[model samples]
Target: MTSTLVENHFRIGKLPHIWCPGCGHGIIMRSIAVAIDELGYDKNDVCVVSGIGCSSRAPGYMDFNTLHTLHGRALAYATGVKMANPDLKVIVITGDGDCAAIGGNHLIHASRRNIDITTVVFNNNIYGMTGGQYSPTTPTGEKGTTAPFGNIDRNFDLCNLAKGAGATYVARSTAYHANMVKQQVKAALENKGFSFVEAVSICPTYYGRKNKKGDAVSMMEYLKNSTVNVKAADKLPKEKLEGKFLVGEFYKSEEPEYTEEYKKIIDSFQKER
Candidate 1:
């Protein structure tokens, strides 16, 4: 029953994803599947590592090798996995909270090291797994259960964070732009260093209802209308740019992957010895 979608990539008896209706995580998951299938990597050679969150549930349904790690530990575990077996293609799927809040150090360091791994941040802007608490990526001035009046803390611009932390490939996409998301994820996978894909997802159950976003459909519409391509985005006049957001491949560059670079240093020292 393998469709052209992921003939080699799809797992056995893992159909019917269980995410809530209108949850953007499912869309991101499909895009990932498509991207991996396009990469032509065998399912056995790929592993999906995830931390505790709604997004983390993704690995469970995937047919390929998967690891459901502790809260905020996806990066650490994935780092170990890559270090132990450099032949494996590891992908980390984590929510905004899991990746940006408690696991922030791991996320930053992994990018700095430029390990041969791909990180996909399902940035739904709030903690969807738990009862909607404010998250590091939640928009400022938005009301949450904790921030009844309004959120005062500024949110981390995830794309900027990844780029600043030295990730070799950084991209932003959304459920609205499903095809674009696939393209960016594929690009990241093809790259040979720390690759990142920040797919802004929709959380109607938490973020939408709390912010009076109407419903899942409305929130999705918002995501669609909010984004602009990076190139055209920069060209937008200042006044027109207000209240709008960009979602596209932001930056990409080739750099020495940490593992390969370390091997080079070791080889050099061995020659001297």
Candidate 2:
């Protein structure tokens, strides 16, 4: 618990997280912890809420006040938590399946309402936890247990979805770029309105080998090559953009967050009383 990411913010007995040997969840978790530390959040002031999935296990491993909630309902719980205690920093960590599949409606409405919660989605393309299955965000042409012939369905463009839903901050990063992930998370925390971050992850056991992508290490390599920051990538040609994802902060704006705005209404009511 003494690494740069674990600096003075971790609680005891949460060490030795239980991710797979080649799993990317651990890397993203480290990024989150580091971001929280950089943002000067105390363990008591931050709450990590998660839905049922491998990513949901993240909160159990963190030292903060955490909530392991129902499947695909992390956003709903996070919205309630933020509304109840506007001063607390609420972070939602959910798997792609849990967030984009079962919990998709909540995700959209949460963004539309501009809740003050920060959402981090661990997207491994395929569902790694409840067996290797297909999630809504699974990339087209990727093979999963359910999609033996390869997935023909379209995948979500998470940044665009968030921006369209009215989130004030939206960004994307992968496990390969751990440093930038932490940086973006910190920025998301500082933003007043709803924030969404998509953390591209690798499931070596389920997603990597099945798709002939080799082990987890190789999957991370794929992420390293498949993504480009818009600022640096715009100079490249259309061919350069082919099959590559645009990362970095895609959008950010100043807007009224829902919870605090509701608090202002209550304050006005108190004055009238």
Candidate 3:
């Protein structure tokens, strides 16, 4: 199955990715590929966009029409791409820092406009490419190179942020939950309006070592133990839910997609002539 996905979706020459060993970005990237393959999208009809970051490196390895755009500007570029050619399937690959920090304004506005783009966030909780700096999604009290003592700022609940910003679909999964990530990405791709999926990943080299979260296996184990599926979470008592984050689909709704609305205006204007 893995070999089939690689042959169908990945660039063979880019086989060996540069992410540090045990970094979960690879798993998240594979999940995206698997989702695309399962959906059977024509490679040419799919457009993947990314911004500068470790996670952003994924587009170079993917076989789809991809754009490695400027830092925090992937959405802006993707919006133009979708507007110019609404037939394409647009997907954005971004890191926690790239999406929630410098690119945060774009994230919210894209959701506000309900554009037909699927955004998958590879959130390792630190700025892995630039150095082990704390990111917007870095948990409060977690240590990073910049926050050696501990991070004092409150972290953003990205799914909630997207849902509040008007994303038509919102979901969360982890690298440890590879199948779940694939399923969520598939669902996000099918949503017509803006879609957001947060794939919680591990930075074993930096975040793990700095916060003493142990090796890659231990981090994966932590994810397995710490997250509760939203469906089961409702049945569990408050005490059982403490310290456990919720995963699974959080929200979904039907809405007018931004590009389609723009086309409607153009059509109306042409009819008036």
Models 1 onward score TM values of 0.94, 0.96, 0.98
Per-residue lDDT over 1-273 for candidate 1, one digit per residue giving the tens place of the 0 to 100 score: 656675555555665666778999989988999888877889889989999999999998887889999999999999999988888999999999999999999999999999999999999998887888899998999977788888999999998999999999999999878888899989998899999999999989888989999788998899888777888977788888788888888889988898888778889999997
* Candidate 2 structure quality by residue, lDDT tens digits, 1-273: 367556465544676777789899989998999899877887889999999998999998888899999999999999888888889999999989999889999999999999888999998888887788888887899889999999999999888988999999999999998998899999999899899999998889888877899987778888999999989887999998998998899999988879878989989999997
Error of 2 at 162 (Å): 0.9
Candidate 1 off by > 4 Å: 1-15, 266-273
* Number of residue pairs clashing in candidate 3, backbone atoms closer than 3 angstroms, sequence gap of 3 or more or interchain: 0
> How far off is residue 256 in model 3, in Å?
1.0
* Per-model C-alpha RMSD: 1.8, 1.5, 1.1
* Candidate 2, run of 10 with poorest lDDT: 4-13
Q: Which is the better candidate, 2 or 3, if ranked by TM-score? A: 3
Model 3 Cα RMSD, 1 decimal: 1.1
Q: What lDDT is obtained when candidate 2 is compared to the true structure?
A: 0.89
